[model samples]
Target chain A: MSRIHHLPLHVEFGDCDPAGIVWFPNFFRWFDAGSRRFFVACGVPTWKELEKTTGIIGTPLVDTQARFVRPASYGDEIVVETSIPEWRTKSFVMKHRILRGEELLCECNEVRVFAQRTGADPHAIRAVPIPEDIRALCG
Target chain B: MSRIHHLPLHVEFGDCDPAGIVWFPNFFRWFDAGSRRFFVACGVPTWKELEKTTGIIGTPLVDTQARFVRPASYGDEIVVETSIPEWRTKSFVMKHRILRGEELLCECNEVRVFAQRTGADPHAIRAVPIPEDIRALCG
Candidate 1:
């Protein structure tokens, strides 16, 4: 069975645009929040833990494709489902779906690659192999 | 001269993930902000003005594709350039590029469709012709 996790999110006022509908970009923010929760649920060290213990870097999204099917409004309670579809040596793909009851609101797929911090520029990133613990959980 | 407007953005701490680099998702936020400013520069109503005056609904992104060539860091000042590539009868396409000085960071293209609001629901969206005023300025 696939490791599936459910996350509940409250639409914040900042998440909406002047139209009173949740801005499309905020969907991604919710997705990232759910992803963090999924990692915690799986016993993987949270981002903070990884930073302190392993020096492991947070994965950076290389590509993302999302489709907004139904509109979500401010103050709506939404559920987000996240699952890993594929795990490779250095990169992995995650799929997320946001729903309101039976209504599908948004679907997204993201590709993230592990990287190591190097050089004087902290943002200077280079692709590295996934850590063993992450691979075990995601694989 | 090409009708392009450049807006400089400071990458905020909230814009970065635990990776210590600017999160890819935040790029869209910057794009939206830059586009809003660009429209204002072109004499188009600010997003707030449009929402109130014409009941002009905000455009919903139907599709978007972004390519990350280089990582942008928190606190980095980046420039976003926005331009209308094509204005269809009811929808339009906008192109955005993020640059750090002379180095290109990322580029994205988005398709937005005019959606009309109906009683708090946006299903009443129909492709309304681009207003001549917007076309003249954007063209």
Candidate 2:
């Protein structure tokens, strides 16, 4: 069985829109944090540390899809459940489900790659092959 | 031909991550803004105004997918071109492309619905049929 990481968060007033519900983009922010927390829970080093050793600055998404099931509002306590369901040679899929108690709020699946700075162009980045040690640690 | 709206925005310093690239979530935020801008450009009323008359709160995403082609950073002037490619009975597909000059940064397609408050549950929302007059205005 794949390991799962749960990150708990609270919805703040600033997180909501005039509609009185959390802005949709904030869900993506929590998913990003959940992704990093998953790696940390698996004994993976910080992206900054890995950057020095492996030139891997971070896991950046190539593509992502999300389904918003239900609306959530401020003062709600939510948890992001993250897991890696698939891995490829150079990319992997990270899944995150946000829930309040037993109610699912949103779910996302992201295809991400381990990215490194490319050449001298600050905006240029290239995906590198999945690191064996990192994969092992995560598994 | 479908109407296309272009929303120009400046990437602020705080928009970039430690990697110096615009974090992916910010892309979605821009897309949402672009979606609204598209409607306004088509002479559609604001969500607040629609809510008062039609009980429609806003266009809420049911599903959204995005592909990141190139990274953008602070100081980049980006334009999000938004168009509605398809419309259904209750949902529509909104497409957005983020470009810096002639360079493509990212693209997204979202399936969204006009949402209204459901019952007495403050957090509950329900998708409503696409209003004919509103659709005509957007078209």
Interface root mean square deviation per prediction: 1.8, 0.7
Q: lDDT tens digits, residues B1-139, model 1?
A: 4389899888888877667688776898888887777778888876567767666777777777676778988889999999888888877888899999999988888777766656656444444567778778766
Q: All candidates' lDDT scores?
A: 0.78, 0.93
TM-score of chain A of each: 0.91, 0.98
List the lowest-lDDT window of 10 residues for candidate 1 chain A. A47-56
Docking class of 2: high
Q: All candidates' TM-scores?
A: 0.88, 0.98
lDDT per residue for candidate 1 within A25-62, as digits (tens), equals 78888888777787878888776677667666777777
What DockQ does predicted model 1 obtain?
0.56
Stretches off by above 4 angstroms in model 2 are: none
The alpha-carbon deviation from the true structure for residue B139 of candidate 1, after best TM-score superposition, in angstroms, is 0.4
Cα deviation of B38, candidate 1, in Å? 2.2
Predicted candidate 2 versus true structure: per-residue lDDT over A1-139, tens digit per residue: 6699999999999999988899999999999999999999999999999989888899989999999999999999999999999999999999999999999999999999999998656598899999999899888
